[model samples]
Target: MTEYNTVLAPVLSAFWDQPNSWTLETYLKNGGYEGLKKAFAQKPEDLIQTIKDSGLRGRGGAGFPTGMKWGFLPPADGGPRYLVVNADESEPGTCKDIPLMMAAPQFLVEGVIITSYAIGSNHAFIYLRGEVVHVYRRLLRAVEEAYAAGYLGKNIQGTGFDLDVTVHAGAGAYICGEETALLDSLEGRRGQPRLKPPFPATAGLYARPTVVNNVESVASVPQIINRGADWFTSMGTERSSGNGLFSLSGHVTRPGQYEAPL
Candidate 1:
């Protein structure tokens, strides 16, 4: 067997706690943001390096390297930039983010903060799939709770980092799942894909440089940051280890967002 399979598969599963472990209280009790605490104590560059070492790949239907993707940004060039969490997973049979948001939206919230801080973005957007009004409402409530708890706002956790997070809804379009199409829909335009190369990392949302990451992708940030990169990376395959939100749908005896190793 490959070494990744031996170490990664069991490591992530070992953390599997009760079903409600998604809740903020539950997550905290289980030593969740202990990583966040540690991350905030370290230099941002070191945190990024830990992720690169851990090998956390993107799970938004595309297995891109999370760290390398963050590295693609230009240094706070004074132009506005954004970290857009794509929660609009309209892909046929894929179902995870909505439920995760419903059960433990703060996971994504704290992740948004850590991600924004890492990339030097002050504002982050959680773009929801418009059809799920109920889910959106749940997210709104969760964001409110997080804000009230000091997770989202100026002076996050006394780190002197000011950040704001907004959860926006889309008009319900499959095309909107495409990076550029999502941006267009976010801007109130008809949904459609745009040219590539100069992708979202360079020119996105309002023509300002943006980092368009999937909901699960952004949510995974806090864990990678808080835990040593080696600890987070010690799961999955050599290329794609670390826990992933597999929005399992259809056929399976239990169709749900199963957090599994890649």
Candidate 2:
């Protein structure tokens, strides 16, 4: 059997075992939200370029390059664009987001702030799987802590950028895992996938340009920003750089989450 230590690169899970690990203080002590600060220093377009250079990809099964996705959003029209996090971890073999949220939600919240700024969104939404009420509660508390720390509201960190994060519980429909269907469900409408031709990048939630990202995908932005793209690119393969959370379940000695470079 292979040693777990040799296979792991625990950036996202680095502080999961600390006492009161979810608190903003613990996060701050361990270098939390540093990415957002770095992100604020760059132009939104430049931020996107940095992520592009990092070679990070979506972990939500799509495996699409994240930077390219954000780049797809049209030039800002000064309207209400959004950064919707697809926290619906319903698909089989897809279980990293929930554990990440349960253990280190600050990563996601901070990532959301950075991503929203990069994509020119002042409003962001986390469409979480409703069944996991405990994780949902953790996320809410994390958001509140971020707000208290001046990371989510008006003039975050004195950067003059404002953002509001809303955590919405899904209706437990598997189809809602689809981006457009999730958007429809988010808008209080019947959950059904919307047609293409106007992709989410162009006409997403509220018919405005929106970027839908998975929890792990957004959770990665901070480390990339704080550590630099070259550092992120140093892990994983040439095509698929960075670490990923692999969920282990059933028939295993220690069934849980494992972070490995991919």
Candidate 3:
């Protein structure tokens, strides 16, 4: 039998087994928003650099560098930019994101706030899979809780940083998992991939610069901000740094989600 004893590193899943793990109160008690406070201390560009230094790749397939993806946006015009979280986990056998949303949604919420602030976005969206009504409801409630705590909305934490987050449910198209397709679906159009050249960074979501990141990718940002780049680099390989959630199922005695170094 292969041993995962020392290989497992459960940063995101660390508290899933605890009582009321989804509640804001529980999240606060366990050093939840400390990362945002740290983020607020740094310049937005520096925040992006930190992720680059951490070597944190996208957990939503493709392994794209998360920081580089953020840096790809053209300098801010006087127009609206957006940060969209792709919560539509519809690929066959792909199950990590849904469970993360259901069990510890605050993690994604905190990550969204920090990401929006870093990217100079006044608005953000979580595009969820339509069939998961329960996850959608949980995400909505989490957003409401965040707003009440002043972690979202106008003048957040008195820093004069305002952000509004919208939770949108898709029609459950598997293609919507693709970033461009997800943007189209979010805009009330049919979910289909668009031709490139004017990639999402150049033009997206109402024809403005936009960033679409996966649930796990955004959720991992809080830890990178809080723990420092070197800490994240200590895990996984030199190329693929940091840990990720691995969904194991079908023909396995211990089939479940495991968070460990990539």
Candidate 4:
């Protein structure tokens, strides 16, 4: 048995017993918007720097730097840009985003807002796997709660930045997890991988500048913004810093999320 370090998840077990844990009221009481307050205090570029400093790498199969990805976009010039969250996490040995969405979905909402502000995008879309109906319902409920709580929708929390996030569940297909294939699925076509060289960051999803990232990658931003970069970079290896949730499955003593530094 070749064992590896399995890291724990943050919001997965954050609140077990509480009326409407997915509701805005519960998330607020549990120190949810505190990160937004901190995020709004800093300039957008500075927010990106904070994430870079945190050394928060992507949690999906790809360990790309979250901050650097956000910084790659050119300045908006009266054109539309989009943030596409790849919730279609169907890696053979992966199982994280669904549970996180089911347990504490507000963490994702916070991440979306902070990321939208940083990338100058007022609209975002989450492409979830269609096989899990329960998770889809839970995510829909979370979106409604965030909208009702003034964290989403027009003039967010008195800031001029406005964002609208939609949860899009894709038809069941494993190939859709590929960045270009997912984009094709999102655009209502057969799921197939498009040619690279023009990655999704450049021309993607209706021929606009789009950032397609994994669900866990999108959800990790709020904490990086709140804790500052130095605090985040303290863990992990030289190339891969920061703590992450690693899931060990099959015949294991305890098959759950465990936290470890790379």
Candidate 5:
């Protein structure tokens, strides 16, 4: 017989079981905006460098390094550079993102703010699948609460950093989960993946430099900023770092979302 050591890490799922866990009040009580505050104290480039150092990868299937993707955007060309979050979780047996939104939307919202600030983006969007109307509504309300708390609008937290978040529900196409396809759908066009070379980073939404991240990927940003890179790198393997949500479904005795080190 062999014995294995197992540990559960609940960074994102820590408060899912709590009352009104989706509400801003609950999130604030649990040290929510601390990361945004910490982010404001540093330069945008430094924030990017911190993420690069943290070894955080995309949670949207590709596992690409998140910091490197953000760094791919060409030095600000004076035009608008956008940050679009791919919240359309349409892959088979994928149940992590929707649950995260339903339970702890503030995690995603706060992360969006930090990421937008880090990339010098004033406008960001959350592209959700239309099938999840309930989740869409939850996200809209979350954004509303964030705005009322002065976290989403101009001059956020009196730091002279401004951001606007728009939650757009897609037409429920599975193909839209692809980054470029999600971008096209976001532009009011039919969903389809675009050819590479001119990737989203250089020529993305509205043909400008953009950073497209997954729901879980963006949601994880706040914690990395709050806890520091070394803390994130401490978990998971040498190639893959930090904690991730594992979706367990289909005939399992204990089928549920599990958050643990990768």
Candidate 6:
């Protein structure tokens, strides 16, 4: 019988097994925010282009190129734009986002900062599923840790880029997994999908230009920012490049999150 690859790729899951892995100190010690540091050195547009050239796609079923989605936003217009993280991973076969946030919350946090910078967003939100109270508490603490470390506040790393992250939990609903519904639920309304045309890019979250991306998509930003587009494109196929977390379930021997080329 042929044997499948047993070794894990382990990019986002690299430090998951470390004791105190969820803490800011642990994350920083393991080269956590270096991606954000490198991102600050470069212009936001350049960063977007790098991601575009990398061919990284959204892992939230759409498989849309992540960089392209960012490019779709209209000009900044000097007004506020927002980045909403779709952490409500309620899809049938989706389980990567929660575990990622639980094991290495910094990955998502760092990704949020970079994506916010790339898209000119000062405020970002993580809309989590409310039923997972433990996960919610873990993420809340993670955000607090990030703030105390100067990673999520004014003049981050002396780069003059100010940002604030909010962790919001949704009143469990599969429909909220839809980006628009998630936004509505986030706004304290009953969870329901909104009509399209005025897409989130144009008007979202209090009628502001918004980029709603899945947790994995946002989490992938740090790696692309730190490693470069060329490195990201080295994995997967020509069109679908880079690696991602595969949610494995069932009676399989090593069932869990598996990181592999997409």
lDDT of 2: 0.93
Task: For candidate 3, write residues 1-262 as lDDT tens digits.
Answer: 3686678999999999999899999888888999999999999999999999999988889899999999999998789999999988987887999999999999999999999988899999999998999999999999999999999999999999999999999998989989999999999999999999799998999989999999999999999999999999999999999999999999988899999998
What local lDDT score does residue 253 receive in model 4, on the 0 to 100 scale?
Answer: 86
Give a tens-digit lDDT track for model 5, residues 156-248: 989998899999999989899988999999999998999997998899999999999999999999999999999999999989999999998
Per-candidate clash tally = 4, 0, 0, 9, 0, 0
Judged by lDDT relative to the true structure, which candidate is superior, 1 or 2? 2
Candidate 2 off by > 4 Å:
none
lDDT of each: 0.76, 0.93, 0.93, 0.81, 0.94, 0.90
Query: Residue-wise lDDT of candidate 2 within 14-118, one digit each (tens)?
Result: 989999888889899999988888888899999999999999999888899999999999987778899999998897866889889988899999999999999
User: Which has the higher lDDT value, candidate number 2 or candidate number 3?
Assistant: 3
Per-residue error at 173 for model 2, in Å?
0.6
Q: Tens-digit lDDT track for model 6 on 49-97?
A: 9999999999898999899899888997999999999999897766899
Instruction: Return whichever of 2 and 4 wins on TM-score.
Output: 2
lDDT of candidate 6 at residue 26, scale 0 to 100: 91
lDDT of 1 by residue, 230-255 (tens): 77766666877777766556677666
| Model 1 spans with C-alpha error above 4 angstroms | 1-23
Model 2, poorest ten-residue lDDT window? 1-10
Query: What C-alpha lDDT does candidate 4 achieve relative to the native structure?
Result: 0.81
Question: What TM-score, over all chains together, does every model reach?
Answer: 0.88, 0.97, 0.98, 0.91, 0.97, 0.96
Number of clashes in model 6?
0
Q: Which ten residues in a row have the lowest lDDT in candidate 3?
A: 1-10
RMSD of candidate 3 to the true fold?
A: 1.3
In candidate 1, which residue pairs clash?
8-235, 8-236, 35-226, 236-241
TM-score of 2: 0.97
